[model samples]
Each structure stands twice: as structure tokens, then as C-alpha cells.
Target: MAYSYEPHHFEDFSVGQTFESVGRTVTESDFVLHSAFSGDWTELHTNRHYADEEYFGERVAHGPMTFVLATGFVYRCGFLERTVLAFLGMNYMDIPAPVRTNDTVSLDMEVVGKKELSSREDSGLVTIDTEMTNQENETVFSGDMKFLIKRRD
Candidate 1:
């Protein structure tokens, strides 16, 4: 059954319940704009000559750029629209691989933990295991994100 978009109470998420988001392809324009916006002039992100010799044969996307993309994908999945009160923070983030141009990246998430906020009865904390994978099914990014989720009475 499709998960409803209604506000999911703190009890809605199970420790292993997982959800997935639609995929988005990385385009040349994504790289160009990201590079310019963040001023990440690293050779791996720009400068083709440096990348061709030092790393992958061609320019690669910035690691942080991929991070942002993953976050956006998760939002598109449902959490943000359904139950999110606010984005608390993320922890143990790692980008173990590069995301190259034309790669279709998708988002997946699992509810890793849940905790009632003693100070807030209207909401609670949900810890999610978030991952971003490329078209080749290689994991490019992984991390834990905590969200303030509304409680349903």
C-alpha cells in the first residue's frame, strides 16, 4: 500500500522501515552550476586536465554537490512533506565514491531509530539511514539524518 502523506506520528516509523525516492540524472549543467555556486574549483570538479591524470578519466561532480542532491531526493520521497517539523542535523556523513556526469542517482532511506522528545510532546526525533546510489548501483553517499517529526494524536 502507498504510504499516506498525512502527518505520521512518532510511532509510525519502525526501526527497519525503508522508503525510496525517484531518481534524478546528473547533468553537465548540474556540475557547472554547482561548481560555480560553491566555488569548488578543485580539479576533480573542474579543470579537466588535472582530473584526467590524477583521478577519474574525466571531471567529476563535487562531493558536497552530491550530498545536497541526496537531501533533495529524500525530501521528494515524502518525509519532508508528510511529517517533518524541522531538519535537526546529520551525522557520520561519508562520500566514499564520486558521482560523474550523466549518472542517474537515486535516494533510499531507512528508519534507524526513534526517540520521544521529553521537552516536546507534539513531536519526536526520527533518525534515518540515508543513501545515494548511482545508475551502476554503487553507493556514492551515506549518512544519518535526524528530523523533528510531528506527532499524530
Candidate 2:
């Protein structure tokens, strides 16, 4: 069984294991807050009228915003809580579809790799293949995330 609400150690992970995160809905306020703090005035994310004439036909959430939100949703799953030592990196991020406002999204996370570090005996590395899909099951974001996780010694 998956540990959705409990902490998971490096030993708890396996190469083929997968987990699904709870869904989160994007909103206009999400865009506004992101813009207010980031000071980005990109029309594709802020101006609906301008975005309506663009390729996606409406405002799309900022690329970074989608990534950040997806990360937060994964964290809310609590599987890594108190067990992660650090975030190593994220690789090959792709926004295949627009993350529109009011779109509900969830993360499908698969453990791509896991290995103990000889030099750092207290921790190990975990690599995750992630796909963030919207309400219609369209992959809106995709990436591989790596992190340092504590060993169960």
C-alpha cells in the first residue's frame, strides 16, 4: 500500500513504485497572486482578452506556476515529510498543454531510481518521474525530480 499521509524513508522507495497526489484546482486568484509577487506582466497569463487571441485561446497559467503548484501538491501527500534531506534537482521540465484557470490537476509520481550514497551514509538519492495531469487527464506538465532522502538506520 502507498503511504499517502505518512513519512517515507529512502528504504521505503522502490524503482517501480508509484504514487498519486491529491488534486488541486487552479484559480484566477492563483494567477493574480503569482503575478503580484513575481512582478511578471505577461499577457498570456494575465490579460484574458489578449490571451483569447493567442494560440491557447485563453489565459494559461505561468509555466513556473504550474511546476510550483504541482510540487506543493506532491508535498501535501506527506510521503516525504520529515524524511527528505534536500532537493537535488529537476530535469527536462515540459509544459505539453496549457494549465488553464479552474483546471484541477494531480501528480502521478513514479520512483525511477533509488540508491544509497556510500560517502554520505546517512542519506540516499531518489529520482522521481512526474506527470501532472489536468481534469481531462491531459498531461499539462512533465519532469523528473531528484531528492536526497534520509536512510532508515
Candidate 3:
């Protein structure tokens, strides 16, 4: 039987709360698939030999692709379900280090703040800071995302 989890309501979220998602690894196929789907043919992403000669010493995973995968991990771990209404936008998105193929990555989220929209009684905005780290424990990317969430009341 497929287990059904009751989604968290906005009221359940509080400042200082932290959530973590399962880890995932970047694979060559993932890189290829993402590159193909997005039409991003930058040498650093699609040309391994060229990348090895110019920079990264080898083909590197696309930055946006890495972010997408990390976001999927978060969703799989149940961070965005009934509690989340709409994804607003991202802030301070930074890809400080290149994610390489086979690099294991995970997501960490911290609830930085929350506010009840005066105009909406049933929903509010929650701002959280998210960080993606590699197996070697280096932060490859970081950002803040705001989501509209339903209030429990």
C-alpha cells in the first residue's frame, strides 16, 4: 500500500526550523539528459574533451541542472506538498563550485522567516534558505526561496 502522509500546513512551519532531503548523485546520463532537454550546449557542459583542455579538467554538470536535481531531492523528501501553494521566486542564487559527475549531493533548508499576508487569510509566505552540498561536504550552491503556503486555520 502506498503510504499517504498528511502534508504540513503553513502554521506548522516556524522560524528556526530546519529540513533535510535525501541525497542524490550526479551521473553522466543525468548531465546528458539535462543538457539535451534544456538546449544548453556550453562547452563546459557538453564537450568533455574541450572542458578537460580548457577548464574543470573534465565535463562539469550544468549549474541549473544541479539546482533542479537538488530541488527534486527536496520534493522527494516531502518538503513541498500540501503545505506549499506556489513557488514565488529565488534570491541570492549562487553556484560557487562546479558540481562534477558522480558527486553526491543533498539539500538543507532553514525557515528564515514567515509572514501572514494581510490580504489573504488562508495563505501566507514562507521564506527559506536552501543549501546544496556535495559528498565532500562543500557547499556547491545556495539560495533563498519563497513559497506561498496554506494556513492550517
**Per-residue lDDT value at 18 in model 3:** 80
Worst 10 residues of 3 by lDDT: 1-10
Q: Which structure among the candidates has the greatest lDDT?
A: 2
lDDT of 1 at 149: 87
- In terms of TM-score, the best-performing candidate is 2
Model 3 Cα shift for residue 71 (angstroms): 1.8
| Candidate scoring better on TM-score of 1 and 2 | 2
Name the weakest run of 10 consecutive residues (lDDT summed) in model 2: 1-10
Per-residue lDDT of candidate 1, residues 1-153 (tens digit): 343243356778879988887788999899889988998777777777888887578888887898899888777766567678888889789998899989999878888999988999989999999988999999999999899988886
For 33-125, candidate 2 gives per-residue lDDT tens digits of: 999988987999999899999999999998889888878877888989999989888867899998999999999999999987888989899
Badly placed stretches (over 4 Å) of model 1 are 1-9
Q: Model 2 has how many clashing residue pairs? A: 0
State the lDDT at 104 in candidate 3. 93
User: TM-score of model 1 relative to the true fold?
Assistant: 0.87
- Provide the TM-score for each candidate, comma-separated: 0.87, 0.93, 0.90
Clashing pairs in 3: none
State the lDDT at 56 in candidate 3: 73
Rank by TM-score, highest first.
Answer: 2, 3, 1
Per-residue error (Å), model 3, residue 1: 25
